[model samples]
Target: MKPATAAKKLGIYLPAAPQDFQDSEVTRAEFNQLQQNPPEWLAELRRNGPHPRPVVAQKLGISISGLARGGVTEPLTTADITTLLAEPPKWLVAERSTHAAVRKQDLIAKKLHSESPKN
Candidate 1:
């Protein structure tokens, strides 16, 4: 499979697989290293889950759809997903705060309306 296709499976982007490396080849040193200490980046991705997709995409100033389309499927390392789970954009933070404020205001308005005499 093409590198991009592989990456999409894992929600990552790989411009091209190393030409000199055989796709099926795996060295003991690399395998041992992975077994001993998996990349922290991958661990974070697994922990965060899919909620970060939109956040990271927005922060990176890239369209969510673009990220989705560019996602890889195979060898879906945790690192790839971690990138998507990275910090959210400031716009989202502001939006969430605004939403909370509006909710609070609505609750207060409702309480006041109910307390007041209705003509």
Candidate 2:
């Protein structure tokens, strides 16, 4: 797989990865190995992340759009994420509630749709 594909699957920011990982193609076996038992570099990246947008959103408990609304446009390191978690700003609180409400609504919609008669 291409580096971008591998990075996406790993939930990492591609540009933040090491040059070798960025330069190489990852075979299926290698991809699996990386997933199952990441090397130190990979582990470090995940552990002290300049995480990808989706990852940042998940850690912040906000939707992607909510991130934009909160001016969190850039990727954040694990420390930065932790700080946000520890002392959530008003926007963060609001966004979390909004995210939870949206998820609840989505679940209800899916349940209702699943229970409806098929055409």
Measured by lDDT, the strongest candidate is 2
- Candidate 2 residue-wise lDDT, 1-119, digit = tens: 99999999999999999999999999999999999999998999899989999999998888999999999888899999999999999999999999999999999999999999999
Q: Candidate 2 versus the native: TM-score? A: 0.93
User: Residue 16 error for model 2, in Å?
Assistant: 1.6
- Candidate 1 runs further than 4 Å off: 1-86
Positional deviation of residue 4's Cα in model 2 after best superposition, in angstroms: 1.0
- Displacement of the residue 79 alpha carbon in candidate 2, Å: 1.0
Best of the candidates, TM-score = 2
lDDT per residue as tens, model 1, 27-107? 566545634675554345434433244444544444455454445223333454455347544554455455567668999
**lDDT (Cα) of model 2:** 0.95
